[model samples]
Target: MEYIYASLLLHAAKKDINEDALKNVLSAAGIEVDEVRLKAVAAALKEVNIDEVLKSAATAPVAVAAVPA
Candidate 1:
């Protein structure tokens, strides 16, 4: 979702991930801002550690398929 992307962009840029910031990013990107969703995302990320989340995601294992000879 664009909302999540906006949050990630802010995190990547070391900006504050708040409703206002999310609105600015969305508006700048020509996407319509949804206040309800923005607030929800901001609240959800309030206690999240983006760095740790990304690190864990990077280290998560993936299933590989075996090729038949």
Candidate 2:
């Protein structure tokens, strides 16, 4: 869980976010995780509001770009 949080932080700190980045982050942390599940988690996580996860480090704030209509 902590590893997930850290990964999110690294992602949020970055200009771009993706599955590869998330996997790299977790792998670097010594966590062996499923790539598919990780991607699913990352996708689900992206939908999470950052403000709700500020109290703890388990969640991360993702930078969302405004899409042109």
Candidate 3:
């Protein structure tokens, strides 16, 4: 969970998302860093465009319920 949050934090700050950076963020937050998770997150984010994903998520429609009269 922290690994994912760290990735998002790095993306939000326009910082390079890498294992060392993610570890730094986790360490700064006083959380123990897990190497495997950190590497996994870095690899997962390698081809992702965080900003574009956020934009599409924001524009996605939500279902609304109609109230009965």
RMSD (CA, Å), candidate 2 to true, equals 13.1
TM-score for model 1?
0.86
lDDT string, candidate 1, 1-69, tens digits = 999899999999999999999999999999988789999999999899989999998888856768789
lDDT of 3 by residue, 1-69 (tens): 778788999998999999999989999999988788888889989988888998998888855668789
Task: Assess candidate 3 and give its TM-score to the true structure.
Answer: 0.82
Model 2 per-residue lDDT at 55: 47
Deviating ranges (above 4 Å) for candidate 2? 55-69
For model 2, name the residue pairs that clash.
Answer: none
- Residue 23: error of model 2 in Å? 0.7
Q: Identify the runs in model 3 with alpha carbons over 4 angstroms from their true place.
A: 64-69
Q: How much does candidate 2 score in TM-score?
A: 0.56
Give lDDT tens digits, candidate 2, residues 5-43: 855576569633457777777778798878787777767
RMSD of each: 3.2, 13.1, 3.7
